[model samples]
Target chain A: MIELKNIKKSFDGLEVLKGISMTFEPGKTNLIIGQSGSGKTVLLKCMLGLYSVDSGSMLFGNRPLENMDDNQRRILRREIGMVFQGSALFDSMTVLENVMFPMQMLTDQDEKSIRAAAHEVIDRVNLNEATQKLPAELSGGMQKRVAIARAVVMRPKYLFCDEPNSGLDPKTAIVIDNLIREITKEYNITTVINSHDMNSVMEIGDTILFLKDGLKAWEGNKKQIFKTDNEAINNFVYSSRLMKKVKEVYQ
Target chain B: MKLLHHIGAYLLMLRLVFIKPTKAKVMRKLIFKDIQDLIVGSLGIVAFLSFFVGGVVAIQTALNIESPLIPKSLVGFATRQSVILEFAPTFMCIILAGKVGSFITSSIGTMRVTEQIDALEVMGINSVNYLVFPKLVAMMLLPLVINISMFLGILGGYTATLYGGFSSSADFIDGIQMDFKPFHVFYAFIKTVVFAIVLATIPAYQGYYMKGGALEVGKAATVAFVWTSIVIIVLNYMITQLLLA
Candidate 1:
C-alpha cells in the first residue's frame, strides 16, 4: 500500500497539490483522474519521487519515502516499476532487450536466464513475435504492452502507469486497461494509474481520486461515481455530451 | 540567494554525477560499450584523418625549407615535434568533439527530454552512474589509444615520404632522433587526458539538463561541439605555453 499524507507541492508560487492525502491499496488499481493541467500528473510524479513535495510525506507501506537516502530509495525503487506516458522504452534497444534491461542491471542472473525471463514476459504480453523489433517498429498499443511487460518482468511490488492508454484507439485502450488491471490483481501489487479517459475509469478504477484545481474534489469507486452529488465531479463527468446523454437516460 | 543556492545545487549535482557511477559495477559495462562505440565506431574517420594529416605534414614541412644549412633530416624532426606537441592531441580532440561529444550530448539529452532518465531513477538506477560514467571512462581512455594510433600514423607518413623519395629514410630517422623530447610526449599525454575529461563532462552536463524535445537534443549536440571546440583551442594554447615555455 502507498499513502500520501498532507502532500503539498507548488511550482513558481502556484500550488499544484494542496495538502492532498490519499491511500492506494494493494492488489487493486488506484486511479487519479482530473482535467488537463489539474495536477494529476504532478501528484503522480510526486508519488514516484520525481518531484519533491514542498511539505508532507509519502509512505510506501509504512516507510517514509521523503527522507530516505539515495541508496535506500534505490532499494525501494528496485521493487517499484513505472510505465511512463510515452512508453519510454530505450529506442536503441530491441523489445526483448528493453524488457530484459532492469533484470540485467539489477540482478546477477546469467544471460540465458535473463533471456528466458524476458521471453516469458514477452509471451505473457503476447508480444513474443515482436521481441526482436525496435520500439519504433511497434504500434502504440504494442509499445504500451511492451512497457507493461518491462515493468512487470522484475515482478515489482508496486506498479505505476501514467497515461497508459493515451493515443491509442478506444478498443486498444480498453485492452491495455484490462491488461493492467488483470496484472495488478494477478500479482497482488499496489498499482496506481493516472488517466482522464472515462472508459479507463469505468473499466479499471477500483479506487478513484478525482482532482479539481489541485484539490481532491471527490473520491469513489466507478460503481458509485454516477450516483454521487458532488458538483465539481458532476460538471466534469456530465460536461461530455456522450456522458450527459447517458446520465439523462438513467435519470 | 537563489543564485547561490543554484550554484551549490549544481556543484552537488556534479558531485553526484561523478560519485554515483564510480560505486556501480554497471560503469564497467557502460565504459566498454562506449569504447566500442566511440573508438571502434569512428575507425573510418580516424583512418581518413591520419592519412590526410600525415601526408599534409610531410609535404608542407618538406616544401618550407630549401637551405643547405638545415639538414633535410630536420624536416622529419620538425614534423615529429609538431605531431607530438600539437597535431596528435589537438586535432584528435577536434575530431572527438564532433564524433564522441555530439553522441554523448544527443543521446543523454534525448533521454532527458523523453523522461527516460527519470524512469531509470525510478527503477533505482543512478542515471549518472548508469549513463554517463561509461562514456566518461571511454572518452578519457580512448583518446590515449587514438594518440598512439596517430603516432604510428605519423610514422607511416614518414615511411611514405621515404618511399616517394621526398626525404631519405636515413635523414628521416636522424631527424626523429634529434628532435624527440620526452617532455613533448609527456605534455601530449597530459593534454589528451585533460581534453578527455573536458570533452566528456561538458557535453554530458549539457545533455543531462536538456529541456523541450528532440529539437533541444539537436541544439545540445551543436552546443556541445561548439563549446568543446572552444575549450580545446583555448586549453591547447594555455597548455602549450605552460608546458613548452
Candidate 2:
C-alpha cells in the first residue's frame, strides 16, 4: 500500500499538488482522475519518486519514501513498476528483450532464467506472437500490453500507470483496463492509474480519487462517481451529453 | 547567470553519471553497443572526409609555394604538419560534431520526449550512467578514429602530390621527415581525448534536459551541435596555447 499525507509540490512558485492526502490499497485499481491541470500526473510522479513533494510524507507501507537514502531509494525503486503514458518501450529493443530488461539489469539470474521470467509475463499479456517485433511495429493497444508486461515482469510490489489508455480505442482501452485490473489482483500489487477516461472509470476503477484545482474534489468508487453530489466532479466527469444522460439514468 | 547554472548542472550531471555505476556485465554490453553506434558506425564518413581534406591541404600547399626559391619538399612537410596538427584532430571533429553530436542529442532527446528516460529512472537505473557512460567509454576509442584520419590524411596528400606532379617523390618524402616532432603527435592525441569527452557529454546533456514535444528534439540537436562546436574551438585554442605556444 502507498499513502500520501498533505503532499504539496510546486514549480516556479506555481503549486500543482496542493496538500493532497490519499491512500491506495493493494489488489485494487486506484484511479486518480482530474482535468488536465488538476495535478493528477504530478501526484503520480511524486509517489514514483520522480518529483520530490513539498512538505508532505509519502509512505510506501510503513516507511516514508522521502526519508530513504539514495541507495535505499534505488532499492525501493526496483520494487516499483511504472507504465508511461507513451508506453515508453525502448525503441531499439524487441518486445522480448524489452520484457527481459529489468531482470537483466537488476538480477543475478542467468540468461535462461531471465528469458523464462520474461516469457511468463509476455505470455500472460498475450504478446507471445509479437515478441520479436519492435515497439513501432505494434499498435497502441499492443504497445500498452507490452508496457504492462514489462512493468509486471519483475513482480513488483507497486504498479503505476499514467494515462495508460489515452490514445486507445474504447474496446482496446477497456481491454487494457481489465488487463491492469487483473494484474493488480493476480499479484496483489498496489496499483495506481492516472486517467480521466470515463469508460475506464466505470470498468476498473476499484477506488477513485478525484482532483479539481489541485484539491481533492471527491473520492469514491465507479458507482459513487455517478451518484456523487459534488458538482465539480459531476461537471467534469459528465461533460459529454451521453455521460450526463447516463448519470441522470443512474441517479 | 543562466550560463553559470547550466555549467554547474552539467558538472553535477557528470558526477551523477559516474556515481553508483551500472553492473559491469551490463556496462560491458552497453559499451560494445556504443562502440558500434558512435565509433565503428562513423568510420565511412571519417575516412571519406579525411582523404579529401588531406588532398586539399597538399594541393593548396603545393600551389602556393610554386616559387623556385621555396624547397619542393616543403609541400610534403606542410601537408604532414597541417594534417597531423589541425585537420585530423580539430577540423575532422568539428565535422563529427555535426554527425555524431547531433545523433547523440536527437537520440537522447527523442528518448526524453518519449518518456524512455523516465522509464529507465523509474526502473531504478541511473539514466545518465545507463545512457552516457557507455558512450563515454566508447569515445575513449575516439583516438582510434583520429589515428585512421591521420594515416589516411597523409596518404591522401601523398596520392594527390604524386598525381599532381607538384614535387619529386623523394623531395616530398624528405619534407615528410623534416622537423617531425613526436611531441606534436602527443599534443594532437591530448586534443582528441579532450574532444572525445566533450563529444560524449555535451550533446548528452542537451538531449537529457530538453523540454517540450517532438519538435523540440530537432531544436535540441541543433543547440547541441552549436554548443559542442563552440566548446571544441575554444578548448582547441586553450590547449594549443598551453602546449604549443
Q: Candidate 1 residues A5-94, lDDT tens each?
A: 989999999998898999999999999999998999999888888888999999998999998997888788888989998999998899
**For candidate 2, lDDT tens digit of each residue in A213-243?**
8899899999788777899988898899999
Off by over 4 Å in 2: none
TM, every model: 0.92, 0.98
Instruction: Tell me the spans in candidate 1 whose CA falls farther than 4 Å from its real position.
Output: A109-116, B1-14, B21-26, B66-68, B152-166
User: CA lDDT of each candidate?
Assistant: 0.85, 0.93
Candidate 1: lDDT over CA atoms?
0.85
lDDT of 1 by residue, B54-147 (tens): 7678778888788868788876787787777777788878887998899999989988987788878888777876776677777767555667
